[model samples]
Target: MESTNNIIEIKIDSYDDLVNHIKGKTDKCGDLRDNFIFRGLSNFEHELVPSALRKDNLNQPIVNDYVGGDLGLLVLISNEDVKSNFLEDRVHIDLGYGKWVSFDKNQHPFFDNNREYLKNKNYLQIKRETYALLKFLNIADKNGLKINTSYETRSKIHNYLNPDKITFWPKKSFFEIISLAQHYNLPTCALDWTYDYHVALYFAVKDILENKNNDGVIWALNYRLFEDNYNESNEYKLRFYRPEYHSNPNLRAQKGLFTFLINPVDEILDCPLDQVICREIKNIGKKNKKTVFDNGKDLILIPPEITENDIIFYKFVISKNAKLDILEELYKEGYSEDTLFPGYGRVIQNMGNRVMLENIKNESDKKPKKNILLKIKNCEDIFQRKINYLFGKFNFNSEIENIYIYSPESQEIKGYFKANEIIKNSPNLIWEKYHNKSNWLKKDFNNYFKDNKAYAIRINGLIEFNFPFKINNLSMGNQFMYIEPDNTDINFLLNFK
Candidate 1:
């Protein structure tokens, strides 16, 4: 009998052990059919074995399915939504562990240009991330740093940079560079997955610690099965990818894989995959209505064919009780920061996580002291009429617009504003709110200020700043709206109240 110590095998004792871990928090009516555990040695197993088959032994024989032979198991952490959320309602509804689907973190904002460029435009993000990778390579070259890159990588990056060059590089090469860029912290569409169960648990537990309120999930899916499905289906255009990039030590350590999202956003913004497919079908049917290839099934935009019986997707929801235990077990098994992140620099970084001073406070913390010399009370409400008047005239878009749906013209104007810090006679009504006589009259408003006779002014256009004008109900014993530019005080609306 094998030692049952292999990283590939799930550490849980039996099927019952796994079930018992989640059984406490799981609702009685919760959908458990989609949820399955690996009874065998290798986690990659098809056919959901019944809980009755779980004996005292850790190792069990694997079963294969005709449809999905042996796919990776996916673990999903249910957000425990009482009613289905936005993403849950739209994407992969059936594959969810519970009634709710997987939680979408929706792109972390820490990455520099993610919020700026890549938030809504998933297709554009692929090209942009490529460009960013090229830029990094250029910087490395300038510094005379030797990067272990191939001719393919060098050639593709060149063509990518020079748009008119008619660049032709293999998808494999492009994926390599993208993977390398991801390793170096460039925001790409690819979500990282690992084969090592311990490493996966570590990532999940780390997230759990940071987000204590929410349940953590370990999601697994068979890449091989997905690839096979892709070849057969015309609906899903995405590829189940595992990059061959071995340059990053962390990548190697984690046994990482990536799901390469291809052209995620279709023609228009927020158009669902099904809707896009429907439009394509309409167009195709109009051209050739008699096209019945696969049993009269329209081969348009197809959602990923994920089902419980297929056993391609699996999710293990780690409740609060299970998280600490799993993390401790992983730590005991030597899956720690030292092992995962090798080398002195990373080890030092890891130590910072452990060695922490007490979150103590000094004398300044105890006994609240009076800091305010004078407190201004209800000064802002005094400018209510003027503020409302300006707001009403500003022509703000009533139909809630975010960064994703921002118009191309608006994006261009914004880019210009970022570079030059001024917009010359901008037509965007959102800019109209900044227009006022008080802003133009300020002395600090120099050549940067572009003001029209209608008192339509743009001030510090690109930079984020607090309101330039403050409503002073009592300044020098008089009520007025104060605007300061280079020590010059401009007041508007003399006291009547």
Candidate 2:
């Protein structure tokens, strides 16, 4: 009987034999085999899952094959628009006897995936360990090179490993160093992150050096790993299409062009797959039980891609009893008055900016998904990053703690509380429940102009009023706001006092 770990490692040559055994195995443990990424490989009708390169995480061997025992340890780093201070060229070396060495100072390795301690790193130790592995493999010598040292300025590897002694000498490009390793048949792997053009260029240089089999790194623009542009670096730069992901194996070589896909996740469901469900779209103090993004206020997506003519479609679903006032605040903050709230869907129920979304449930002993769904799409890029804003609002589960809603009118001291409350109380307003319960830590205020009306105040994205009241457009830091509307409705709301 072969172990499951073996299934994770190498593959057997017999398809019929593998299928019968996999079927028998599936019968016992509730079809666990199908869940693996290499499910077909288990059935023998599949060939071999190609070997991902060796890893170089600390305390873990640099040569540890990604396709190992039961599970292939995957290393991923965050690929976001926001720049990382740690993402840079680094030289790591191992000086034997556990005395690992590194060249980068105050640097960390960025692993985009959920790697084993791969998300973590100690720069010095990593370099030492890496160097040691090279020396162990005779890729470099353990002679009189600077072992443990930091370089604020650009220095040479000869400071550590003797530059005078190597089959492939170090050169100008860092890619050349990794290539030197390839020359020695040392398998190397790096955390695959979303390589923007610049980063892609950098990785291409390294990949070329280590890759020899002419596997054709020349991936198509649509192929996975290929981003915006795949350069045809003819001589020094080369790329090829691998057929692994295509429909046919014979067409693999010529067909596989590198492209970028959504980040890989263990489960398909986790990716959200173009279907972003607005589980709940309300103000900060509502109880729709959705996840919240950022510290609070409005959801914030840093370095959000702002392209002209990009449309943001937003769908909000709330219970009939949820706070409408919070939704109003969100709308006002999320969009300017120019934003069109087209259809004639009059306000039925209200609570802050978050209105009565879907159906209201009694204080039942159970919970369920919201029934009502409201959809809104914002067109224009930076004019209003509504898509990023709405996507942020859906992540309402994790409440923000330091989020404070300042009441300019209230002279009283209303401080921080895990559970949100109005600064004090509105003189002529009634407050009601909002759809912000998903974010419990931040204070959510929904004030009502009338008895049943709800409005939450806003400081950042915190709802301050009880009514879904849209305060006239005011800058984030600016205090005074003058409304000069070209229409009658705008004129009315401005001087309604």
Candidate 3:
């Protein structure tokens, strides 16, 4: 079978949870099911099957549902709440397995028959995983999902369940192939985010295989020429796809997703993925904190922005404090030499950076597709400079917003091309429908920065400009460059002229 169709099919993004809801599931239960949706296979009809943990051959003519039919659907549900401190209630409510009901690992296949599994874990996480997996299995049981229940299917399922995200922590274990081979009938898979060491190593390799190819995985390891890209200690990682010991094109390609994870705030940020070895899959609650091997590792620290620092400048470090001089902040956390990020000035200094306000002149100055370069005398007049930077992430983000909204002057924000009936019609820069507090600031230039005294206004009484500012906390008064009345800097209006 073609690899595309020959997949160990699973579901994740598209299964509606309404069916489970109707079954009188939890009120907060998810309406969408998450699963391993694989679509690629080589054989289907008659394939060799392995005897499961039972050590006996599976029944011949494996149940149609049992034979990985059209696709493989393994739905897993987690009973653990993800947050419960089982350290106190460390005893497992013995149902079948030995009397050890603990969750050092996250993706333990949950069974409806087992209620003791519901221990300390995120209510939402376990809910999403558990119901999603089970639902897939139920569907497969009834109609025979496509996939084989053999050795290869097991390997793939294992890859999908544990995933690469968990290797940062090794203690975050999952069921062994033997145990998994025991209970599950149809292709089954699960997801866990527990903090563990040994498990992280296995998952790291598995993650490499499933997600990337060859060049990809190796690249995940921060290669060191002179310990410039990474620290010497960080270089202690082992490359799983090295040609001498490891030579698998498929395995190497999957490693590309690996990143050099560094957490400076926490003592434990060494949750290595591929090159760096990490076993730091902490409890589900720790969202983005760095996982260190012990609580003693020094984390990269940056000084918080002291608004009163007399020097109204900024530095560009890892975004710890809300403020810094500019984006040029850099300090070495590890032994590496090359600055991880080259600060903000380098970004703003680019000539073709194309701020939104300048885009109109840019497009107008250029023909259709030939090296588009537009020049403007003033950055303020053509359009508000701040808006351009705010929405620059999208080549079409401005267009989408314009089609949906209007502008400050009630200009009915649209492409200037359509209104002018010009030859090469370009969309207008201002969006009228964008009737939020942001546009309101543009409506009144004087009072815009009146409320917040910390503004850095410029441009003769017309527009505002702000770059690299996260929109959430910023207001016209606190952090913006505006043009107020009575001031006439031709730079603002003359840019368009």
Candidate 4:
């Protein structure tokens, strides 16, 4: 563990160690309920910066070239009732003192030509435009009221042009819309944090998987510390905003909140929250003429009267090797992508992640091989005729390692087995166990003989009866179909238990 004033950094070897450390801070009687909020990074070296504020040289130009480019335009485009023509016309913005600027549909305050103006003014211009569009479309509106006309929309936009006009709407309403936009991948000044440590750990493991060579980090901030020291009169203050979660399932599941670094004088500062906090602490130390230590990076100033035990920030670096273990543990605790992000798209993404993890585990254990789908016709007469041909006479593909059996009659994939498992077992043993037994067994074997060359594979004691799903895009007459490794269906099948 390395300590720097009020910031402590701990290197964690495994998931258990991470949990134990968090429990030590949270489980004590003196600890306030939900004292800490966490944010996870894929790389331990990453700084605590919001997505919109990150200074990416290559992408910054693209983000600034258009309004809401960094934030995403999906929220704007998805509303069918909201016409784009409302914002297509050129409009003049008053910069005060008779200085005026014109911005068309493609131009924004963030453009290079507008760089001479104050950044806070530019930031407000973007926000006003975004809020106006949202209000015009009635997207996630608390009252669900629409602006009805382009004139009304323009009026709302013009109203927010002035700095003092921000107070026109209730504070909660303003933050709610911005938070909603942020949730949908729009770039915002706020950083996302979760009250649940497990969610943070899950995201950390997820990041480590994507960047396999890099170690992950989870930053835990003492919520009580921020709450205790927060002053409304401070020139620079950190504000915590928890939007109502009823409208956003993802936020509710993740127990998410946002931390905003507010500079009343400037309104915008392109620095991480930790650095801002450290700077404020350092200034306080200097005012009192107390001894202060600064590392220039990850600095936190502690007064002489304060003890090290009152540390407010912690960073835990987790080893990349523990990624899989942590993910499995999180899944068991119901902290998975499907739960955290409730949507059809996230469900598919979760399955893809499961498939990738399975492939990784399989590759680590043995040589990887291809998986194939074997479709069969479900009929008793067809099975009796092809029983002799499919058991041993018919040659199976050597490259095919796993065979998934599909039934046409039921339109469902019944189960699967390893190609070698079925081939190594004698034909007599398979026939004895499955032949003339249950009706379902007969249908499964019958499908193998429909096309005379054993289109379907027979399932015996060697086969695993898991992974049953409906066969998609296959015609009723198409009894024998071979699926390649790259087929999209493989992702769903591989996710089976």
Best by TM-score: 4
TM-score of 4: 0.54
lDDT of 2 by residue, 424-483 (tens): 222111122333321222233222122212223222332222332242432333221122
Collision count for each candidate, in order:
13, 96, 97, 4
Q: What would the TM-score be for candidate 1 when compared with the true structure?
A: 0.39
TM-score of each: 0.39, 0.18, 0.19, 0.54
Top model number, lDDT:
4
List model 3 lDDT by residue over 103-209, tens digit each: 32222323222333433233313222323333443455468643223443333333443312222211112222212222233232211111111121222222221
lDDT of each residue in 14-99, candidate 4, tens digit only: 56557656766222112322688998877788888766555446535222433443331111111221223332222233333322
- Which lDDT value does model 3 have at 417? 14
Superposing every Cα of model 1 onto the true structure, what RMSD results?
Answer: 27.6
TM-score of 2: 0.18
Poorly placed runs, candidate 1 (over 4 Å): 1-126, 141-153, 156-170, 207-212, 227-236, 264-308, 349-497
Per-candidate local distance difference test: 0.36, 0.23, 0.23, 0.55
Ranking of models by TM-score: 4, 1, 3, 2
Model 1 residue 47 lDDT score: 20
- CA deviation > 4 Å runs, candidate 2: 1-59, 63-125, 129-158, 161-172, 190-497
Whichever of 1 and 4 has more TM-score, that candidate is 4
